[model samples]
Target: MKVTKTSSNITYDIEGLDAETLLSLYRNMLKPRLIEEKMLILLRQGKISKWFSGIGQEAISVGVTMAMQKDEYILPMHRNLGVFTTREVPLYRLFAQWQGKASGFTKGRDRSFHFGTQQYKIVGMISHLGPQLGVADGIALASKLKNKNQVTAVFTGEGGTSEGDFHEALNVASVWQLPVLFCVENNGYGLSTPTNEQYNCEHIADRGKGYGIESHIIDGNNITEVYIKVSALAESIRKNPRPILLEFKTFRMRGHEEASGTKYVPQELMDMWSAKDPLLNFQAFLKENDLLNDVDEVEIKEAIVHEINEHLEVAFAEENIIPDKTEELNDVFKPFDYQEIISENVFEEIRFVDAISESLKQSMEKHDDLVIMGQDVADYGGVFKITDGFLEQFGKDRVRNTPICESAIVEAAMGLSITGIKSVVEMQFADFVSSGFNPVVNYLAKTHYRWNQNADVVIRMPCGGGVAAGPFHSQTNEAWFTKTPGLKVVYPAFPYDAKGLLATAINDPNPVLFFEHKGLYRSIRQDVPKDYYTLHFGKASMLKNGEDITIISYGAAVHWALETLKNNPDISADIIDLRTLQPLDTETIYASVKKTGKAIILQEDSLFGGIASDISALIMEHCFKYLDAPVKRVASMETPIPFASQLEQQYLPKNEFEAELKALLAY
Candidate 1:
């Protein structure tokens, strides 16, 4: 593929431009380049730890940011130094991050390039290419929900287009028509490999057409062209809200990073790109347009040098970057306290679905920063209609609808959560959570532990079996995270518990996993709270007390156990509801098991490596002495949950309390 020459040039685009925008663009690009160059010097002098230079792509960064309005979000690539430099990141913080200072916004835990904050209207950068491509889509999705005309601009390298995330993000962006602009810095190489060897496609922009995303190409080195193209694209994006890819063809003036010298770059190729320097090209454009007077140009260069030096001085002096401490260690086995949470139900006779809905309503009413987003959650209430009338009641921003990108959806929720907003993520199907594991496990679950700051995001997963949801939809995967520390897990059986538990989960300082049973979506009926009521995470409800044996269950299983207990009057059996499983209510379990002198751990999940095992272990460790007979655990057999009712009942443990209770009584 060869470069396309357009009729319009810098002189044509700016018919009679004020010197301000042009000079500002030139000044921005020059500062970042000099910063990168100065940083490289620092790295060599042993004053800095790591450095990734963005010398080649200055034009795209400066142009795109210059065109973007204030308060609009910008998600940058590691190479877009100009964007972050212009956007609220103080030079000192950027320098401080590289120097390994704790004063860095992320407390210096995050790498230097992985910076800026959503609260600052500057979506943070992710170094791993293609991973953050979908981030802009999420911010745009939020803007659409808020009924706010905000355009989110995301930067990427030409090599990033090859990543699967790129395709997934762009497709979702186009399908939902999100107001996002994908800016690609096509610097002719994916690290060492050139574009010719990397991909056969003529342009990355062309790939967007297949997904129905409007796209364009521009001279990335020409800041004027970059600004004009982004301006036009951003306007169209906010209006129709469709995905558009803008390929900015440019070159990197320096090697990839401080340590990486261009061993592969040929002398001829280097000479050719030398004249195409974006900073120099912009300087010439400004000179030709009479925007660059000799005195003004000298002042711009001097000011930047002074600014960079000042940043270096403060950054090194700042006491940041805590050396890895042994004190940072936390036990995976330990449980968090549920004492801060207080809960009580007010209303009576409400549906289980309404319980969840009311909890969100009450929480949203109380907390102004709460954000709700997922597929079909905006105009429509949701798949189960649990969110029915939510959009109409709350308006779009707080209750949002999103394109079906599960990973991006959860990630954005994680981002919002870190910003002090209580964000509730709607996973249309609980099984879809596999798509979002990286951010959930790597970032959200570990954020607080990594730093002193907590991640208070709540992921609302509509889970469970009994709905003929085949292989992908019916599985119970909460066990995957039950073992994970720093996460509070909740599964409510009744409407009262549902409302109370949900409120508690949302308010917790740690990340919370809320698995709502699909079968109970419209099943059980009971009274819920009108005002906010929170249930403790570690508390276990003693559903029914019996002297014969103890039955421990939760979620849908709790309802089944209750039904079984009512019919069996001969055997005095006690029932325990394990409200929140992470910090399992061992006290309640220990007390009930000691009283009954027998215990049966029951659950819908498979018998192998499931929660039942955890409960059984808890009994053996604490309540084993209380057992009059051997402890028993009843769970579904190890097999894919079958669709047929009879097959499912046979494969799954069904009402085993009758036989189990009789056996225990005779013992």
Candidate 2:
């Protein structure tokens, strides 16, 4: 499988490739080109909204896909239409998706290229280009752990290499030696910016050396060269299980999209690249080799065009199916049979951090596919020492320490989850979760709704501000995710709740943000059950029952509420601890509020647009008639957590909660 260089073009030792396989590759390239041309026509006629063409880059898609096994996964970008065709994805399904019909993969929830079908082992692209690289790495990681010989091929453009996820994915893949092929379709221009402007490297493949991965540069227009090189690389990767960075030097003949005219592209440069179009060049090559006669060429063209026309006609004739309004509320989280847990008589007093670590250990023991990955999580046992001794128990393969790439960690976890391997990702600090917010909100949270795919990932976020960890270290970012539609946000107060909630989050078939208050990690210790048990999400635990007023809180705020109640012996209030925030325990809160006829909502986050606002509104909406006084909210002031101990204490809502509670009781 050696490559031979020539003056004008490259040749590969592809003597084994028969005429039939060569013809099939050509057809694969031609079919996409014809379909893209039809898509442009549809756009002009106002039949479609937009299109991203893979006119000049079809060789890379067809070549690389032809090299892959049928069971191997493909995470495709918008321009990889040839990959879809090679995977045997129906042209009608693609058309139906473009037309926003329910028959499509996403059931019309997502249109165009933002969709994927599990049936084809393809995960469609999100708007962000780089995250899918990490996801592909995760899929490969899963394959290695499950003892499956599968490689995951992920596509990105030259522009996408600029993203941090590109570096993160390559580094992780190389370190773990996962079987993944990173296909960088270096097609000259990223939207309007050329390669020189996007990167300083001579070639995108040059960066692979820094990550210690095998890399190669191939003439993407030459189908034979691409197929031979990629096939050899894919075969080697399956045996050795290491990532290879392969850069395909090709061009995009059209503008980025239909509405984006060719004004940005220079005519001379376009003319030069257009001559090297993979479809036309391959057609000429076949004629030169006497592999494709004129009749054979005409027949292939007619057959492809006829198939495209038939699919388009049927797809266009079909009614565009809008999802039912009720469906919008559904599929945010997969339905689970509620399992009742009987508390065990055996109990052990454990710290909050130990509870989390124990739950992760138990989950891993129960499900062999559960993987824990994060910064300093393996050898150092994490910055908080929550995962201490985990590496010894689970080994480095399952317990992994990753580079400081929050986005990649979460995105990779999503990929693993999609492939039936549940992953737990720990952000070093909850405040740092903002770095990975794009994937968390756009991909992980939305995957279930978009394609009915279960992104069974649990993100362990150590949140809240109490210790003098300052603005960067101690910030409560729960409100940010709580506002997002398809995420389950859980914040635990004590060790008992922490263990149960984390266990539940690991088993749930959706993305769960398990927030452990850093302040309470070592401080809170209680006798938690030794036996396995799960706490139901969207349920509240009552700490105290009183007739005068109700105090509703979660996380560290719940402890403050309990302490406030203890000090105020005369003030009788019902205290409720909401374990999970997204599926809020409104019924529990409403019942407590109805009984007391007064309510006070509290949290550690900023006052404006915080969880308190939502709880206050909920009480007003559901328990308005039962209330004797207006629902009050006590939350941290609208300011960043200060570094000084005194300022931080003043900035928090501990004192505020007591005052608000007394006022409510007095009223």
Candidate 3:
């Protein structure tokens, strides 16, 4: 393709030339520009809180979107107003979203561009810029695994290229050769941080070559050029899957938001770009080629203005659905039909680690779309050999070994889960989860509440301090995630509970943090059911019953409590093992505490801000009348786990639990 420039217009010599398509492109670009202008007016009038304008970059968004198939997925950023317009998103719905009305896509949960329509195959971006790129990579992986001819277009800014997720996503996409388009809107500045400050590279596309993927750069202001180039690229990707990074060099005319002025931008640079405005340039081209008459242009503009006005009126009349306080707890976990079973046949004996591996194998066999991904998980069988022989059992496609990028691991799972795939991710150690905490807490935990979407992903965490594994390798971090809504935290001590709970977590429709104590990996053994079985979350297992005192514990602490009970046979006490943390089995604990009239909560984490504190508070509020003594808690000291075996032994609360139980009984 070649471009010819005349005094009044520019023309392109493309194979499939049609006047109607060119007019539609101009019309699409104009619609978003007008809507953004209206939104700015609303922002000034205090009708809307803020506005992120896509004034001069419409050509890039509209051109790329028009090239994509309707069924293909598009994960858009804040400034991709042209994307929504090209996808035929109703103008009124966009207005209602900005107005924070209940009828909006997010049901008034999220304001601004943080909303997406599942029906349209669009996933909206959060305030964070880089994680969504990894999510789009997972979507493309899902499409490739399912043998679907679909492409996922992910948009990001020039500043986003600096994030670690950007590199991680690009590497994974290229390695897997998935059909994904990394559209970088290089507008020169990332919220006042110039390109020079962000990176030393000359162009963002230069980084793509290092990842072994093809890269291209184009003038973002030219509509016909972007449309033709992206269209051809999309077709090639669908035919033979692979990732391609495209850099659209454009400029943001307005500031980051309406409140922020353009004072930071140099006046000379602004003047230089203003002369090549995409809408004006495209209109001039249309007029010069005689493709659009003045009357046609006027009619199109009038139609768009009328439609936007009608939508605005309707949206303003609609009521905002303020969320009720009670509804906050709802939709955190999807409800499922569960039944308890008593097996008649002899159970198969297995170790804790083997049971976990077996459960993963069973889940993969049951669901073809279920995928297991982590660092060294495929051929090496994970860091702990928990996934041994998984690659041969389930091919490389289902069992993927990812790079040492924790954020991308979790975000990609979020992406796959949204596209009808169940993902199970393993953190090498629970302590290392801090790297991916942003996506885990902000994105995965809130997706269901914010967009009414399911994040069907399970993050396997091997936690707790024991066997002298220092601070980095061992830590009981369940309390950190239990406070987060939209996540289910499950910790099992017995092999039976570990296997059954893993199955339930894999099947649950919400994100789950499955904590497996590394100390119990080979040390514990039990008779697990050979057939498939699921253990219910938010339920406590009463190991032994006594009327004196109730000892509540989970994970490795449950075994310590059991051993304490065995040593002191005369001190009769009831033991309640909590299988799940987030959905605390308060009902069971309340009943046990009422029967015993005394309670002792045990944990292996630090004494401060542990799950035991939450349980102690619950006992005080619900079972205070029946309590014969204050609910005691036995937990590790408020310090990091030591590397030495003796110090590590003292660091845990195993020995303290027995003394606490004896004191509770004596009280």
Best candidate, lDDT: 3
Ranking by lDDT: 3, 2, 1
Clash count of each predicted structure = 9, 0, 0
What digit string (tens of lDDT, one per residue) describes model 3 on residues 1-667? 2235535333444347587788889999999999988888888899999888889999999999999999999999989999998999987888888877877887777888897788888899999888899899889999999999889999999999999889988988888898999999999788888789999989999998899999999888888889989999999999999999999999999988877878899999998888878898788777776777799889999999999999999999888777787665675556656655444556888999989998899889988879999989999999889888989989999999988889988988988987889999999999989999989998899888887888899999998888788989888899889989889999999999998899989988889999999999999999888877788888889999888888899999999988887898887778999999978889999999999899999999988888999899999998899999999988998888998999998888897777777767777
**Model 1 vs. true fold: TM:** 0.79
For every model shown, what is its TM-score relative to the native structure?
0.79, 0.96, 0.97
In terms of TM-score, the best-performing candidate is 3
Looking at model 1, residue 565 earns an lDDT score of 70
RMSD of each: 5.6, 2.2, 1.7
Candidate 1's clash total is 9
Model 1: lowest-lDDT 10 consecutive positions: 1-10
Q: Ten residues in a row with the worst lDDT in model 3?
A: 1-10
- Kindly list the per-residue Cα lDDT of model 2 for residues 80-104, writing each as its tens digit: 9998998989999899888887777
Stretches > 4 Å off in candidate 2: 1-14
Off by over 4 Å in 3: 1-5, 8-15, 339-345
Q: lDDT tens string, model 1, 364-448?
A: 8877768887888877788988788878778776887877777766666654544456688888888888887766666566556
